[model samples]
Target: MVEEQEKRRSSEDEIDLIELTRSIWAGRLFIAKVTSVFIIIGLIIAFTSPVEYEATCKLLPESQEAQMPSLGGLAGLAGLAGVDLSSMGGSSGVMTPQLYPEIVNSLPFILEVMNDTIYFERQDIHATSFNYFKNIVKPSVMGYILKYTIGLPGLIFSNKPEDIISTKDDLSFYRISKEDWRLIESFKERIILEIDSETGIVEVMVEMPDPYAAAQIAKKIELMVTGAVVEYKTGKSLKNLEFILEAHDESKRKYESVQYQLARSTDRNRNVNSATAQIELKKLEYEFNLAYEVYKGLSSQVEQAKIKLKEETPVFTVLEPVRIPGDKSKPKRAVILIVLMVMGCMIGTIILFCKFILVGKRGRSF
Candidate 1:
């Protein structure tokens, strides 16, 4: 008796699946029409979307300051008090690679990028990144729609553009008004920065409409960050170099003066046969030796300072040089069309399934 009931339920399940499949097959034309409409829409969107070019750069940040002669020194003693010796270019640990993204996105770093002059090959024009964004870069159709429609409230409340006054010598003095500030902040969206912990490599990527500009921006940000790191690491070493240079110069002058005086004294009393002459010669010898030793010590210090500077200035080894991507990084037209088509087909299939079930053809099975 149980075996017979199981067979009946199995037969009902098979019939329900067949009916569903048949219902889907009968409305295949409707499914095709809906899918075609979505595909057309997808094509329109894919073609109209802005083509974005990506530029990528990778670098390894190396700290060689500890290799400088006697890097630990008295900084080791001061470390007991929780004092950071990095301020004096000593034993303190170097900045971690993780904060590189923050540095790259920082206001000063972006400003440095803005000050750079780049040629937009496609547009056949020369302009700073900031100026190009301000005067050029026309809005896309979608951007306009969003601004007036979905983003209408935010756009209405946004600050008005400011008329900045400036001249050739004072271009940097223009007050960055609220609207300009917002525009400048928008640069953060076009850049990406990351660090690979396992490999200890820094990667920076930039996107722009023009390939050349994209590549330039990537390289420019790399240079700015490199310069900043080098400057920070070698700050104390450079100052030490300056002080040693000055001391070396002064000691050299004193040594020369002593030699000159001794020469004059010997020449003036070359034939003297008295104790006074002997005492004068001894005094000049003592002064000359003192100046020579001081000069020699300063010379050695000068050399040491130079070596320290070289060691402290970190070398940013480029693991991957910035390359102009051959294809647009966005829009993925084929994928977009496939997704839209699949969505349309699913909707059409569901509509057919509901219509067939609600007509009472498969009501008994449910």
Candidate 2:
């Protein structure tokens, strides 16, 4: 009977669910303290961060226009020869279009941009092209010597005479043998390239301190790319395409004249009933025809070249121009403040909860 009574008393001593809830409510101060801490830290991060403004433009690489005559002539030739030319139609004569975006980012292209004042003069902190420490050789060498005298280990590596020269005149020394390669690396760092995998539309983005400057740089890049494509497409290549056409016309006239004369000779010999003379005339006609064919092929190639050039001039349909940003992209104050306050509150709550659990555990152990 005594053992049964003791067991009943112990069962009744177990924690009650309602009582625990009352205890937790009594610890409202602990929850309030945790929430306060997180809010303060979040605000600090939001205010101090640097603001970055981005300018972006959309572009589609210029696609080549098919020269209908060239394709027709090739198809005709293939048909007459009883060969299939369907596979050739898919080929662009050049490499795949997929590779062009990377090619645009190549060193040569980067170097061209670097030479522009928009990139070189405005982008960097130094307002002028002259960074005196980089330009004047004497100051640079003296600085290096001074560093060496001061026991600076970095100066020991500066052994070459050119290396000792001021880096300002040509920053390419550190960039490697190629100026273009250096520019490419620098440009890549400053510019962001994004391409839509499905649509194949490209977004060229640049972030700068000034919104206007960012917009200008983006605009300049578009113009440069357009001009480059134009030059590449038209084999008239800085030369007038009209000139090549005129020369091609003259060649055609000369070839046709030779062909016409040979034809006349064969007819005359046949009319005279001279088989031997006819055979000789036939030989001349074959040669003239061969020359005429060569001239025709050359004429076709020149026209195709012109057509290809026209296709290379890339035009961008600007989906969105660079807008003057109203808000700075950095230092998201509200988010930072909220996060910091939440974290602080979490830490405080954890500390209070652990203290409560530890106190309860100690009392039970005692």
Candidate 3:
């Protein structure tokens, strides 16, 4: 009796599945209409979307070990002994690759990038990045729609002050307006920087509507970051060089004075055989030699300091150079269409099921 009841329940389940399938087949026309509407919407979105091009460049910071190969073996041994020898040989403090991303994202760095001149191929104009983004780049169709509808309040009641202090007038402080802050946010979105800590490699990516502009901005950012890094790493070394140069100049002057005194004393005492004259001549010669040695030592220190400054300055090797992208990076129309169509089908099925359930309940009530 149990087996017979189980068979009956299984048969009913199959019948229910068949009925649901037939219901869907009968309402195919309704589903098609929903899907068609979605497809049209998708087409509008895909077409109206702004195309963007991305340019990327990879940079590898020259390692401290690579810069000083002679010290590499010693450094390794010292590491085993729990001592760091990487800072030896007049090398300045290390600026790790991990800090590079922070450097690129910094406000000052972004402002520098914004002030750089970029050539827009489409517009056939050269302008500062700030001006191009603010004035030249126009809003998209949806952007305008949203601005008028959702963002209309902000426009009407904008709190932007008219008499804002300019950076040029107040060099010590930076005061930015609301619009400028929005522009800066947009710039942060366009510029992307990534770093690999293990390998100390940095990748900079910039996306812009214009391909040439994207490439140009990417290259400019790369150079700017390199310059910043070099400046940070060599700051101490430069100061050392300057101090050594001053000492070298002072020593040189003293050496010259002593040499002149020694020459005068020797010439005056040439005819005298007196002990006092001989003693005076010896003292002047000794003074001259002492001054000469000090001067020579400072001169060597000056050369060494200059060399150290050069060595401490970082070098960035471009693993992948920036190039104008041939194809757009966004607006995947096919994917968009497929997604919209699937959403439409799901919505149509839900509506049909709800209607069918309501009708069945009303029939049973009757």
- lDDT of predicted model 3: 0.84
Q: Global CA lDDT of candidate 1, please?
A: 0.80
Per-residue CA lDDT of model 1 for 202-262, tens digit only, reads 9999988899999999988898888877777777778879988998999999999999999
Clashing pairs in 1: none
* Best lDDT among the predictions, by candidate number: 3
**How many residue pairs collide in each prediction?**
0, 10, 0
For model 3, how does the per-residue alpha-carbon lDDT over 205-324 read when each residue is reduced to its tens digit? 999989999999999989888988888889888888899899999999999999999899888989999999999999988989999988877876666566567667777899999999
Arranged by TM-score with the best first, the candidates are 3, 1, 2
Candidate 1 has a TM-score of 0.76
Q: Ten consecutive residues with minimal summed lDDT in candidate 3? A: 79-88
TM-score of each: 0.76, 0.51, 0.82
For all candidates in order, the CA lDDT equals: 0.80, 0.57, 0.84
Worst 10 residues of 1 by lDDT: 84-93
* Candidate no. 2 TM-score: 0.51
Task: State which candidate has the highest TM-score.
Answer: 3
